[model samples]
Target: MEESDIVKDIEKKTRLTSLKKYMWGPNILNLTLIIMVSQQQFLGRLSLLSTVLLLISIALNGITLIFFSKEIRYEENQQGIHKPFNKLTIRLLIFIIIFFGAITIGYFIR
Candidate 1:
C-alpha cells in the first residue's frame, strides 16, 4: 500500500478509537444513573442535584452519539460503504431516549 493509504488507515483507526473513548463516559454515567434510579427504597429519595446531573448526562450522551454518527458516516463514505442506518446506532438511540424519558419522569415525580 502507498504511504498515503497507510496514513489514512491510521487516521481512521484513531478516529474510531477516539469515538469509543468519547462514548465511554456517557455509557458509564448512564449505567450509574440507571442503578441509582432503580434503587428508590435504598436511596429513599432523589435530590435536585441528581436530577440536574441526569439531564446533563443525557445531553452529553446525545452530543457524543451525534458526533460519532457523523464520523461513522464520513468514514463509511470514504471506504465506499453506503449503509446509513446501523443497527447499533438505532439501538443506542432508542436506549438513551427511553432512559432519558424515564429519568425525566422520575425527576418530576420525585
Candidate 2:
C-alpha cells in the first residue's frame, strides 16, 4: 500500500481503538455507578434488579471488547507486532473475569 493509504488506515484503526477504550473504561464504570446509586438511593436496596442490569451491561461490553480487539489485531497484522495487543487482550480478559466475579459475589452476598 502507498504511504498515504497506510496513514488513512492507521487513522481508522486508532479511532476504533479510542472508541473501544472509552466504552469499556470510563463508560462502563459510570454506568455501573449510576445503577448502583440509583438502586441504593431510589430503591432503598430493595432488589437485585440493578445488579442484574449491571451484569447485562458488563457482558455486552465484554463482547464488544472482544470484537474490537479482534479487529485491531487484524489491522496490526501487517506490522507483525502482536505482543502489545496480546497484553491488552489479557488485561481485558482479567477485567472481565473480575467484574463477573464481583457481580456474582455481590448478587449472592446481598
Candidate 3:
C-alpha cells in the first residue's frame, strides 16, 4: 500500500476508536442502572431521582446505539455487504427498550 493509503487507514482507525470511547459512557451508565435495579428490595420502588437517572441512561444508550449503527452501516457499505441488522446492535436495542419499559412501569406503580 502507498504511504497515503497507510495514513488514511490510520485516520479511519483513530476515528473508530474515538467513537468507541464515546460509546463507553452510555455502556457504563447502563451497567450502573442494572446494578442498582438488582439491589433494590423486591417490594421497594424506584425513587423520583432513580427514575430520572434511568431516563437519562436510556437516552444515552439510544444515542450510543444510533452512533454505532451508523458506523456499522458505513463499514458495510464500504465493504459491499448488505447486512440490515447486526446481532449485537439488535441486542443492545432490545435491552435498552426492556430497561426503559421496566423503569417506566416501576415509576407508575410506585
Candidate that scores best on TM-score: 1
Pairs that collide in candidate 3 are none
- How close is every model to the real structure, measured as TM-score? 0.64, 0.58, 0.59
As a TM-score, model 3 comes out at 0.59
Cα deviation at 38, candidate 2, in Å, is 14
lDDT of 1 by residue, 17-89 (tens): 6776776776677667665664544666777787667667766776766776677667666767676667557
Give the local distance difference test score of model 2: 0.61
On a 0 to 100 scale, what is the lDDT of residue 55 in model 1?
Answer: 60
Steric clash pairs (candidate 1): none
| Model 1 ranges with Cα > 4 A deviation | 1-3, 104-109
Query: Candidate 2 lDDT, tens digit per residue, 1-83?
Result: 55697787788778666755655674466456445633454545635676667666666766766666676566567545566
Query: When superposed on Cα atoms, how far off is each prediction in RMSD?
Result: 3.4, 4.6, 3.9
Q: What's the lDDT for all of these models? A: 0.69, 0.61, 0.67
Which portions of model 2 show Cα errors greater than 4 Å? 1-46
lDDT of 1 at 18: 77
Clashing pairs in 2: none
